[model samples]
Target chain A: MSPPVAPLGWSRWLVPPAALSVHLSIGQAYAWSVFKPSLESALDLSGTQSALPFQLGIVMLGLSAAFGGTLVERNGPRWAMTVALICFSSGFLLSALGAATEQYWLIVFGYGFVGGIGLGIGYISPVSTLIKWFPDRPGMATGIAIMGFGGGALIASPWSAQMLESFGSDNTGIAQAFLVHGLTYAVFMSLGVLLVRVPRPAKTAADGGPAPLEGVQVSANSAIRTPQFWCLWVVLCMNVTAGIGILEKAAPMITDFFADTSTPVSASAAAGFVALLSAANMLGRIGWSSTSDLIGRKNIYRVYLGVGALMYALIAWVGDSSKPLFICCALVILSFYGGGFATIPAYLKDLFGTYQVGAIHGRLLTAWSTAGVLGPLIVNWIADRQEEAGKSGESLYGLSLIIMIGLLVIGFVANELVRPVHARHHIPAQKEAVDVHERQQPA
Target chain B: MSTSDSSPPDSSPSGRRGLITFAWLWVGAPLAYGLYELVRKATQLFTG
Candidate 1:
């Protein structure tokens, strides 16, 4: 059956908001840190125990997206958005129930597993559709949508914090917060599911131009066979690891870094720092990525991986010497982190063609899952050991920063390793000629 | 694959430019504020 087409007017404007609903809801994962202290104190859980929901959520986000990419492509954005809305909202509901009943595993299952599915599906749903709609400006289009994901935390963090404060940061408060998130997001995300529609087939091809560079197309199945894919995997893993290492500990790290300085970071100031980092993360998604379209993907990545390494080194070497320098370097690093996420889809488009770029991109997110764990593990483990050794403040994070620098350097090398695939791997001109001849001869 | 027979729309260049300008303005401010926050935080990291 032919899909119904709506008259074009304001519908295009509806797309990004639909994308935002899903992104903003799952993007709450970033604010999980705000609840960590409460979870620890109330549940009498260890840091590692409290981190499980977040860790599992990330893991599921990557895994489900990777596995569900083909399904998303086949089912279309509306279907994908619907699934994301249901799972994501349900995850919140489950987590709320778990919190009220004091079932940690339920929180993990609900928010981590189910919501992660929502994250994975919601993330890829609009990506390809947006790319199709704005072929003239794929980077900017994708950046605009993905930026919502990063910025979602900015809104959620403060709001969740307020809710916790009002409801009481006790277990009951956390439960209420979870309940509110589930109920509110269900309504918010439904707008996307209801409003989203796939572009008409003829319009889809028209939006880009004829002869959409099919020769360079690589299916997600074939994409994994190439060494370029693995190299990018390493590059993404390292970049995320470096950035998240600091991000996961933004509040404490900032306070510790400035503790010895004349103008020590106050509690409120430290919270503001975390908010600022979130903002930088959100902005970098759009700003640096739009910049990437001009400079080319590889060159922008050189900035992300190479300059990122330098930022980490400066942080480690200086050890909180000048607060201005530390903050400046970290901000640049986080911007790159945000840019890395935004620019990668365009990069995939450049290499793989748009055939199944969304799916390919989804599969690549496994690198994020790996870094999610690796970054925290390396940083927190080092910090814990340092604390045991009587180290405090900036000293505890120095080794972690050093490790992050090493990872970034490795990522830099991997970025350097990226080159255009050889012509042999490309679809042959003869095959294309035959296909064209067949089409010309009539079905 | 080469379907160029359709005539282009007759919108004035000024109109197209206006649309582009509008798009940038619409999406630009919030994006800039987000970046400002990053810069502000980075400044704090350095000075504080």
Candidate 2:
């Protein structure tokens, strides 16, 4: 006989811990910059060269999540969480080994290739589960899970910095830090795996009535065929690219922008700026996205794409003339960046229905992978070339900011393209009616 | 379509009572903490 399923009660509550376990562990990705100074000093690498691991890790995160989405749906959350635990923890172990041996390629392979897979899988594991549990509040449910992803960095940034400080900030220290990360995360993530339980179908139906379906229904297979899917893909790609351009180089970019101005960014102040941006990114995931439920999905994207472009323009034009302006524009831009991630699930729910939104969401993450590479490359590459041409400080990043503006404009157009799917694609009403009528009027 | 015409009433709430308890222990606290953290983080951003 098959094992007894736990009748669904409050499995919804379990979703957050599962989300935090994955997000907090993967959030270590953001803390990589703390180790950059040590790596450069010990390995004698250039800035761009040192950034390779982080860039590759992000690239892999998008790819693995996109490709593994369908498999996750079929095998269930337990399997996905297990794979994430193994890959993410092992990535850290391998990075520790690489650091100890002074092997850069190993670091790339372990942290970027292996760990990135963990990041992607872990990121999506709780999202669909949370949505299923809280059908009454899809946006709020998703926001709760995604908010962990944003805050993961807040906890990790300070913790990693403290570890590096204690461990000597040298190659040896870095390796030891990596070992601690591997061991501790393995323990932390295991709690989530143990606690996670899939809610039974009967229980899910009991928790909420048919009201969960709202006004639309679209199967996962049909969802991919619609123009709405492609429009959302464009929207996500543009939003991520705009935000990550600044995030990938938060420290250097801020310092560069203010170097020639009257108020030079001190080392501590630069670190504070990164912390502040991270805080904004985390907050926006919950705040702006929760607000989207009240304000409608389309209206919210208008703010993200429309206001986002204006923020970029202000930064590019004004330079560093006003510190308050610079901070305000960056905060708003980061908020939109974060809102893009938090809101996309609801956007999927809006257009495709919740049938297999997890799988559809998995497929959509390819846009994130594409933007992950494009955003950083456009900004860093342009800035590098400009620096070589004798540009310095704020002037170094001006061209990259212009490119971000162009991308946001395209995203705005894509958001405008979104509309409800045609009724022809919905599940056949006659078939649904027959199923219900058969149960109502006995054989 | 009448209010009294839906599916039969649940007879297994007792069987799943343990699970309801488990859900609170496992899921509720962590989910609540995560939200609290988000609010705390946001306040830091706006205020700082």
Candidate 3:
């Protein structure tokens, strides 16, 4: 079915809110840590057991997005959003029921399997719509919407904690919290469904009108075949892996680094560091990605990967001695991490075209999944080995930091290799594809 | 592909502004609340 174009008098500006509504709600995935302690205690589970839901949720998010991408493209944003709302909210409700009954398995099935699908679908749902609405500034448009996902945890962490506190951290209380989350998100996401509008299709080039793509347009299928896609894939994976080294260990690493200092870092201060990182992540999504509109996407990645490697090296060299320097490095790195995510859609649009950018983006998210695993494993495992070897303080992270620098350098190289999709890979300019394209452009 | 739709309805400048405002407030209110919560949590580092 043709996507729902904005009605007459509908301002294209309104579309971002619709995208944000869904994004902000699904971004709650990042806050699952808030419920971990409660689940472990109430369900009498081990740390690893309690973590199953969150880990599986992430795995499913990648899997579902990779698979559901084309289905989303075929059906349009409305259908995608509705599916996301149902699965995501229902995942919460089911988990609520599971919590009430103390069935850990049920909670896993509900949250990990069902809720994860919601996360994936909701994540990609707005991308194409936002790109269409802001064709002039695709990076800034997707940045605004994806930034919500970065900030989702900032909203959800405290909200979930307060709910657990007020309702009692027991089983029923957890259930109540889940219920509230499900219901509230359902209502909130409905607004996006109601408010979002696709652009009216453009007139054909034959009619002396602008085409949707200003340059070479590659279909998702053809785009995937090009070496350019794989190069970008490596670029994204390496960048995320390097950044996750710091993010996954922000609290513990900070405390460990400053333990021998005259003024030791406290637990509360470490928490603040995490909060600051979130702020950096959110701001970078909007700020750096918007900057990419001027600087060019390829140049922005150079900053993220190249300068980011330099920042990691600095952290390794002077991190423990200067708290201010450490904080600055971490914030800049996190911002680059967020910027990396926000810019990729526009990058894909540049290389692949808007026609299947969402689907292509979905496939690309698998790189994120890989980096998610690679980053944490490298950082945490090395840190663990260091601790076993009787290392302490800043020494604990020294090697891991070095490794991150190397990974970032690799990412920088991969980025430098990216070139425009070759003519051989461009989708043949069929009349139907052009028709679909014209229908999507704004008047 | 063919262009089949009629001309778009003309929107007054004020109407466009009002709609943009509506969209902003709709998304902005929640984001502002989120930021408020973050600031409150962040204060713990200094206070604690």
Candidate 4:
């Protein structure tokens, strides 16, 4: 149960790569959409049936992260990363077996359940550590690592698509792809397990060394009891709901919108659209979060939620009449979405301090899980109902777009309501003083 | 808690530079590959 350490004389900068290894590997969760069509056709499954594994995986990701936050905090990043590696890779291995045997439930249980645990644990493993390492730039440091999660899908989408193409797209091909993904990611994530290290205990500030407690510290247990936490919870959930609503249906929505135009979007063009969104997502994670370090977390989220709502309104108003406008709106909304994710850890740190920021972050991700369900359900259900009523093109999505705009407005209000945690929520100075005294007592 | 607590300095200058270089390569390689794929996809949008 000792904290992790780098080899003799290693620099703190090396830690980000360790975080990236785990995030890039588990971030494959974002690319699950790439497998949906292949799995549906191969297994004789309906769209809903095919979506089960992905939907459930997101649910498990939030749930596990919420519950496992403490264990990760207790155990250190090496243990958390190792556990993530085993579960995530094994989830893929089990999914391969499921695909080979044609048991769809196995895929759901394996990828959705086991693999998702890996996602949750792997995600939070780096946050508290990164904040501690770059106390000077918590936003930027976490941004660098979390941006990998956004980029993960960018790598996996084309890679998985190519793998399916070469391997033949049959049951066996899917299994082979799954197996390769599992093995490769396992090896890749191992670098994180090997390299990540917690800083050695801080020396006194008088010695010109790292000192703990740079700001007011709120323990994780106390953070949840405050109104600020729940307000942020709403803000995150609504922002994600708005962005994911579009993301889950990006390709089809574009085609449906532009189909009647002279320049109808081809399927390949639609895929390129998805990649463009990923690029924006990745770039915004780093770009906006770093900007938050300067502008402050609260001000940046005003842009994410408030301006994001405006983008949605513009899309709804302009409809599909201008393709460039449509794409531009979508890209900006998605950048805010990614920015929202990247910035929240620092937001929590700003309010709660680095003491249990990781655990607080884990609790906050329940918002993502909730949004994962709500976002797609709102978009797809409305679109499906609209289509049954004979609506086509932009009409199919217009209402859904409006609904998303409303959600973003609600998120904007929540963000506006967020205030600093009250003094009652902060850890009593006496308790902290006693702990420091006890630690310094000769062991 | 007050605002004056400073982050620990890196153990050494060369070691810090080496670690930064190592980190860039390790994380940067995969990211660059993803960017390449996205570029390829983007080109298809116009090329077609």
Estimate candidate 1's alpha-carbon lDDT, on a 0 to 1 scale. Answer: 0.76
Lowest lDDT 10-mer window, candidate 3 chain A? A205-214
lDDT of 4 by residue, A1-443 (tens): 54565445667778889999999888889889789999999999999899888778788889889999977876778888999999999999999999999998999999999998999999999998898777778888999889999888878888999999999888999999999999999999988988888755544546533345556889889999998899999999998999999888999999999998888898888878877887888888999999999999989998998899889899889887899899999999999889899999999999998777888999999999889889999999999999999999999999998898889888888888998899988886556534433332334
Candidate 1 per-residue lDDT, tens place, A314-396, comes to: 88888777877888788889988988888888888888766677888899998988988898899889989999999888998
Per-candidate total of colliding backbone pairs: 9, 2, 3, 0
Query: Which regions of candidate 4 deviate over 4 angstroms?
Result: A6-9, A37-43, A205-212, A430-443, B1-7, B10-12, B15-19
- Enumerate residue pairs that collide in model 2: A13-B27, A14-B27
Stretches of candidate 1 exceeding 4 Å from the true structure: A1-13, A37-47, A100-102, A166-176, A202-215, A389-393, A423-443, B1-48
Poorly placed runs, candidate 3 (over 4 Å): A205-213, A432-443, B1-13, B16-19, B46-48
Q: Mind giving the per-residue lDDT tens digits that candidate 3 earns over A243-313?
A: 78889999999999999999778999888888888888899999998999999999999999999999999
DockQ of 2: 0.12
Q: For candidate 3, what is the DockQ? A: 0.40
Predicted complex 3: CAPRI docking category:
acceptable
The local lDDT score (0 to 100) that residue A337 gets in candidate 4 is 89
Q: Per-prediction interface RMSD?
A: 6.6, 7.7, 4.2, 4.0
- Model 2, residue B48: displacement in angstroms? 14
> What CAPRI grade goes to candidate 1?
incorrect
TM-score of chain A of each: 0.87, 0.85, 0.96, 0.92
